[model samples]
Target chain A: MFDTERVKLLAERVRPTAPSRTRLLPVLAPLASLLPDGGLRRGTSVRCGAGPHGGALSLALALAAGPSAAGSWCAVVGMDDVGPLAAAGFGLDLDRLAVVRSGPAHWALATGVLIDGVDLVVVAPPPHPRPAAVRTLAARARDRGAVLVVVGPWSADHELVVERSSWHGLAEGAGRLQARRVTVVARGRGAAVRPVRRELWLPTATGKVAAA
Target chain B: MTALPRLLLVECPALTVPAVEPGAGGDEGGRRLRLFARVVDALAEVCPWIDPVRPGVCTLPIKGPTRYFGSEGAVLARVAEVVTTVMAAGPALAGEGTAVGAGDGAPPVPPVPPVPPVRLGVADGLFAATLAARAGTVVAVGETERFLAPWPVDVLGDPDLADVLVRLGLTTLGRFAALPAPDVLARFGAAGARCHRVARGLDGELPGWRVPGTSRHLLAALGRDLALTEHQPGFWGGASAADERAAEVLTDLQRRLGPEAVVVPVLEGGRGPADRCRLVPWRPAGTSAEDDRGLHGRAQARGGRASEPPWPGRLPPPAPARVAAGGTGERAGAAEVADGDGAPVAVTARGLLTGRPARLSVGGGPWMPVTGWSAPWPVEERWWSRGRRRAARLQVLAGGSEGRAYLLVVERGRWRVEAAYD
Candidate 1:
């Protein structure tokens, strides 16, 4: 004597008012168009890599900047020499940022612990990471509603690659470095199946992200 | 045997209360105890190991704070600054006449008491440090005996022993210390023997010097126990629910991976990206709430300013994303810069490049063409000191304009990759 219609109505009434909205973490305005939902989706893992010319670390820091500025606790693991000044330049709240310098041996363990509590974790995974560790980390992030941004190769839900980058304001025996423009390509498995490309300044003259 | 710990003793003359009779002076004594508690609380910001010796005095081991603040002189200056600010703000915080009669409607503002000066001194041990504080001088290392030589025996706080010593022609500590230890022990018993050792600067403490239950008295005055029972979440800007959660895992990770494995960034004034920011070990809140509050208060004060204090030679914004781990030559990768003729490039004494950098190699890596580079920026640090360094920096663009960028530094004819714009 199960009534399918009544059950369906009850399920709708108990569901979140806007499930997608609550699940999304804000991103910078210029980088929003590159994401499917215009923000980082919680519990999702994203992989970011740099081209031969570098911008991956900056881009990853920029992505985390959104949540960190929005009062989320962010931990950067395996990046021992991460420049906090550059992170601050990218709009991260330095007060809430913790840098965990875990060696390759404890990289997975550290990231897993951080994922259990932190809102966003940007980790540089060790080379040849164990598949089991990767699976457990992704599962933990999902279960804990944390965002994982990997700075290396991984089977991620979304992938962002710095397709190309160029530094501006320097010449042979001339001016100092001032800014960098980059092309970031975004692709994912679900709604973002189609690849997306965006051109922006990874860091402008004032050390903040802006549209190129 | 390990050397006696170097202690910094701070004495507030106005707050000292007689240990023999508790609350003898009634309201005035209680007020002094309350004010002393506030002083101790404020000094906790400088270092957490402050030991309240009695009502008006405290001592802290200076070694740890010296290392953190860079030098003993700096620590002394900081302690002086903190104590002065606290003393200046004491009366208003303690409330002028509120304690006299709480139920009285709008009690008249009582006359403000003059703030007493705080005495700061450092020496080898507690006894010597206390004397040093009274004299307002620092006893040089291995010089405590010399510093204590001229002090009268009466300062040891034993009237009967001091009277007997004076009658025996041992008026000064130096004279009394000259007596053989066995002779002194044989002549005067245990207490006199201990006092003789203190005079010689061997022992740092004496019986009855530290008043028991001082913390209990302080707690009674402050109306709360010294140890906090629970943490106040969101007590500061970053202390939100998310912060509490993050702190839990971070602390757990620290326990597992070791404390040094986890760090939080502290921005400071310096010329280079690495110098501008420092990574310090993360400490859980509440356990050291005063320390955190002090640091955050300083940061917030800086934030209230118009702009950061300018470093004349600091690289223009757009700071490098990845700075080398160590300072100067420690972790920087060796780099070779060559000109179009393949000759090694160098920076001259006048800070001009001897040759245009056309190629570069880092850490024995494959050589990349340096398509573009900036003029050298000269850096002369600590020039007046013996460890002075003269170096030059160059911004090099390798591969192409859109290729990799590096911050290259040359010191003593050697070059290294100081940072990357990755």
Candidate 2:
């Protein structure tokens, strides 16, 4: 009994804007268990830190391998420790990585601009931002379908955390240094509510990451 | 930055040195390039991507970013605003390493001098845009040929190629470009073919990548491979799988993510991480790094400079991951190096290790430390030049276990990490 034109107009007026859905990005086999859906989720930030020895850098590079291999450009901002050659050793395609070494002050804004086009954004954690600033950056990443990987001691309530890292290879004081294995613990944050736990070698003896 | 040319005379070229030396400083355009590049980056705040044509020239594709503005003229006004601000701010603010925010709502920034000479041009192709920019004229969208009709043929940069047309009494770009494509290709060869394409407002046809010295050979190969269909057997007129598929994917991807998204990076042959590679904008399919640079050998042949001499005492492989790239890439803070024992070692002016740190274990065996290290080799080139050259290069390679080595540089009384052996 309703007029067709009136009904169509009512439906259009009440339509809900769908949440942006980003395609899953590739993740290295070693750390696949760390992320939800066994892949690097878009619009999400996964946190990592330095291992007992020196595993933080090795782990960060491992996270980049998958997406860069998938033809997506990745940028590492403010992490002065890692360079193109070391990244190349970790199996990252240097051509796809644009390293922007900005100071602590400009990290958030520079990262926001990079996320617009870049698929993956890795930043060395700066001092915790005010809540409003964090929300703004998170919103930008979500809108652009970019995944932010925060390294170092980041203060934001991160969805994923790879903690209690330990390095193995060198005997008490004799043999050569070799691998990094860490326990990746995940927590529910924002609207996403789910937890995960897994163990993996951030880098094997061959200088590449794989299952522990 | 040109405002501080007197500062540059002090030999502190800093980050803008790369773009500044050859383009602006080389006496070619006598224009501000560092300012031009920064203006483009600043424009990216509103406009998505801009194709930089050289030191004095660049084009913003208004069709894309103009949607955010009320009209195309608004977008042009915003670009012109950035150009004037960057140009007026001078080169110091252009600091190429980090992009400082182009804040709209600012708590007082530097004063911007009035810029009246900055020009913007709109047209069908980049070449036309450049011409219009030079004349400070905006060509209508569809009337590129008409706009170009009255222009002289010498507008083409290549004089040898343009002279043939001048001799033929063809004064305008419209007259030369209107000739048969095949006849133009046959008469003037490859370089002329490019000029003809530009004249015809078909500037989009030129290869996107910067053509190095191997260009003559690469151009032929590109032409031959583009239309080939030998791989696909069934189709009468089809492209082969490897050749066309790569180009097709490259172009298709470029369309979606802007031109800067898809690039071919070429590493030039040289020492020093920063000096080793030059980034070329475009790459042909199946282009190997070995074949990437044919120009370097020719330049070397002409100059036979010592810059490329085998740096014997230079650092080993596994170069430092980050070179700051602006001002001085090496941070003044992270300049110290540690020995095997995790102790900081003092490097004497003679480039010798003053106090060797404790011998710690290296993966395979006990670390064997060197009793004496080599002297710091000093490199000072172009002592007479007022600017645009390295004043000194201090290199020393020492330390590490059996398989590991460290290369360090001492510049301006401060130490720096250059490269290291794996």
Candidate 3:
């Protein structure tokens, strides 16, 4: 294992940089494909679809489970539907979750404050947020090395977009509503230079989310 | 060698307020505490050993400070004068030149409110010092016995213990303290014993009553590690300063917004998404971290559980991130339930399910028909309780071209999407 290439890579890793902006955070194994780096890239933003109550919220919980379970603090701001029972079921370590349900006017400000200490921040963007304000929060998240997950009605500068989500468990009737299979499309002008598409089960029948 | 330490208790009114309405007494007490803190911080040049007991109540051990000021009474007068000056000059000190008839173009400075009553009590023990302050009097050194004798036993502040003492005809502190310590303990219990101790002015010489964080005598009380004792009083000052500042900022934020505005979500055991977690006010530095450890050990104990068998019907892991406990909120989870493209779904008795649901097409895309599905998992919870619940969890694959899936639940005889697999 003592090779010149390994040494060179190790040297590059140790090279000095702005500390917080470079910290890497974990994402659930199933949600890896949704990110450009196959993991939650600190200081970047990702947009996911808002589902029919359980849709986006469940996926967001699954995405946050990896980092939160690994002891990284996650904050869900302006999101109320995701109750503690659902959050706990998603394998999210509840001890580390800070749900900032502050009003609409204070969501962005609360997100900014939270990003400084937490590893991941999932927030529902206000109905109409000015581009400048969104950019400021993204920049701040990047500066603080936190992953910013925007849920619901957002179309702007994001590193990736996980959309076109469809529920998988229920049929017309006479059956149990169980899993969900969603389409993950990568679209952004940043690291994801080329668009990539992948299909996934946000959660399988066993109550676990995994990539297909 | 001399014995007990002299303690001063500063008793300020409006320390605690009753909750009458919005922005009521409790919050104003906090504001008053900050004003008191500001006054104390300004006087840090003289009084260094100040310890806050509660909002507007603090203990100032004046033994060393009195040495510099010449006498105990002199020290008291100095503090009173400082309080008067600060109250009078507060607005003038607040910048912006906003004063009446100011040359600068701005609104006039408001008239300063009259200073609140402050009682200064000097005694040998905390209980006695507090009592002395509340009475707005000072007990001369070693005359604490006579001063305490005439007061009612109710001054102990334990109403239950005082009640029994009154019934037993031990009407005054002197009569109460006259009883043998062993007899009081056998008769009245722990609180009564504590009352007996407070009555006797023996607190200053008591083993635990020494001035905290001081000279060799105090260090000896801590079982002083002689080698590490000297010159390290402020060892953790720099680190603690930043931590304290962070705590202060969070405390200020909690005050500005309603306590619920900032919350820390803690997971508790429960059967459904609604019962599993609750919000507690957030503190950047709180006992919550340690509290979570205890919660982790007792993670199985659902919040507010009474005497009932634990319900085994719990939502499986990979809990939904957002569970709309109530069907309606800022973000509605599953308000309307239908089967197979806007068609209502019905769950028949004996665990059978049948219904037609609506189709969902986002962005004007073609409707994805939910084609195939599995059996219904019906759950009836808390049958023993008055508000029992019944729901059937279902799973189905929706997309025709692509095999997409979603999780739905039929509760209260209606079907709504609970989660999705994608």
Question: In candidate 1, how many Å is residue A206 off?
Answer: 0.5
Please give the clash total of every predicted structure, in order. Answer: 1, 6, 51
Instruction: Select the stronger candidate by TM-score from 2 and 3.
Output: 3
Candidate 1: residue pairs that collide: A166-B402
Best model number under TM-score: 1
lDDT of 1 at A82: 84
Residue-by-residue lDDT tens digits, candidate 2, B208-265: 3222111112212223332233222225343233223333333333432334433432
- Cα displacement (angstroms), candidate 2, residue A202, comes to 3.2
All models, RMSD in angstroms? 15.9, 21.7, 19.7
Reference interface contacts recovered per candidate: 0.89, 0.12, 0.48
Instruction: Report the error of model 2 at residue B380, Å.
Output: 17
Error of 2 at B198 (Å): 36
Question: What shift in Å separates residue A68 of candidate 1 from its native position after superposition?
Answer: 1.0
What digit string (tens of lDDT, one per residue) describes model 1 on residues B95-145? Answer: 454553234333433434554458889998789999999888988888999
A1-212: candidate 3 lDDT, tens digit per residue = 68999999999898756432235566777677666666777777777664332356666777788877765667787875556555655667765666776678667767766665566888887888877878888888777567887876555344344455554434445434455566667666556377777777665655666777
Give the candidate number with the greatest lDDT: 1
Q: Which ranges in model 3 have alpha carbons more than 4 Å from their true place?
A: A1-22, A28-41, A49-59, A83-91, A153-158, A163-181, A188-192, B1-257, B264-270, B277-318, B327-344, B349-351, B354-379, B389-422
Q: For this target, which candidate reaches the highest DockQ against the unseen true structure?
A: 1
Error of 3 at B185 (Å): 66
Which of candidates 1 and 3 reaches a greater DockQ? 1
